[model samples]
Target: MKEQLVFATNNPHKIEEIRRQLGDRYTFRSLQDIGCTEDIPETETTLEGNARLKARHVKSNYGQDCFSEDSGLEVAALGNAPGVDTAHYAGPQRDAEENNTKLLSELGDRKDRLARFRTVICLIQGDTETLFEGVCEGRIATSPVGHGGFGYDPVFVPTEGDGRTFAQMKQDEKVRISHRGRAIAKLQEYLKSRSGADRPTG
Candidate 1:
């Protein structure tokens, strides 16, 4: 039987991305899958804190092993103003387009387009907690470039890529170097080690 783990999120995009990266090694259950309908509060001021907060909430409330991640786009010109508030950068509505627009507007005509996407993941299991972090150095585009990725993907270009926004790249391509992908990779490594140790040896 596959190990069942809960992912503390209802966003289909994030779920899909993570599932693709991790493959079939383990079964994942989203917040909705576990019948959690309440809007979980992310009152923390940092990405790592928010990830831990969500994971803890799910583990405590539902009595399940779970993991949660929080990602943000930190721009140099803006002094990383929208670090923790990446989702609701524009308003409380959490509109991606509005957030992108506000980001561009605030960074108007600024030569320094340096930015980076950061992801922090928190995993909770059986009284043990672990955290993993990933970062993708890049720059913000002058305008939205593609229609593929969610959130700031359309406006952010990875430094190692061919100058295309993440939204413009294929799913597999993006996952290989994305902030979430890197963080998930670390989590995957840790889980694999744990699974191996838990197995009965001959």
Candidate 2:
């Protein structure tokens, strides 16, 4: 039987991305499907810490394998001001536009727009935890780019391939080169190698 994994997030987009990446190798479900409605604190100071915390929470609470990811945009010009605090850069409940505005305002007059997006993924099964990370270097645009992607996608242009930002890329294209995509690819490789192996029992 295929292993059932819970993605420790309420974001449908993220869950869909993960599902597409993993395909038939694993059956993945999100917090909503698992009836996890409780909001968890993301008070960690680092991306990896936050990813691990979310995965650990679902694994412990639901007694099932869980996966989680924490991603951020680090602008070199702003001293990485929004690295781990990407979600709350403006305020606890602010949306993407507000967060992007805050970031742009902080980057005033700074000509060096070098920045990178990082994603840390954590996979927890029982007491075992595995971590994977990926990064995409780019520069922050003076204004938003295409309107396709969410969060900070519109304001960042990658260092390779496309002249347009991530927001302009198709979903499959984005998944192929995105930081989260790269990280999840590593996990997929790991799982592919252990495809037929049995999951460790408690």
Which of the numbered candidates is closest to the native, going by highest TM-score?
Answer: 1
Candidate 1 achieves a global lDDT of 0.94
TM-score per candidate, in order?
0.98, 0.92
TM-score of 1: 0.98
Give the clashing pairs for model 2.
Answer: none
lDDT of 2 by residue, 37-96 (tens): 899888899999999999888888888787899999999878886988998899989499
Q: lDDT of each structure?
A: 0.94, 0.85
- Deviation in angstroms for 190 in model 2? 1.0
Residue 148 lDDT, candidate 1, scale 0-100 = 94
Tens-place lDDT digits, model 1, residues 59-103: 888998899999998998888879999999999999999999999
Tell me the spans in candidate 2 whose CA falls farther than 4 Å from its real position: 196-202
What's the CA error at residue 11 for candidate 1, in Å?
0.4
Tell me the deviation in Å of residue 104 in model 1: 0.3
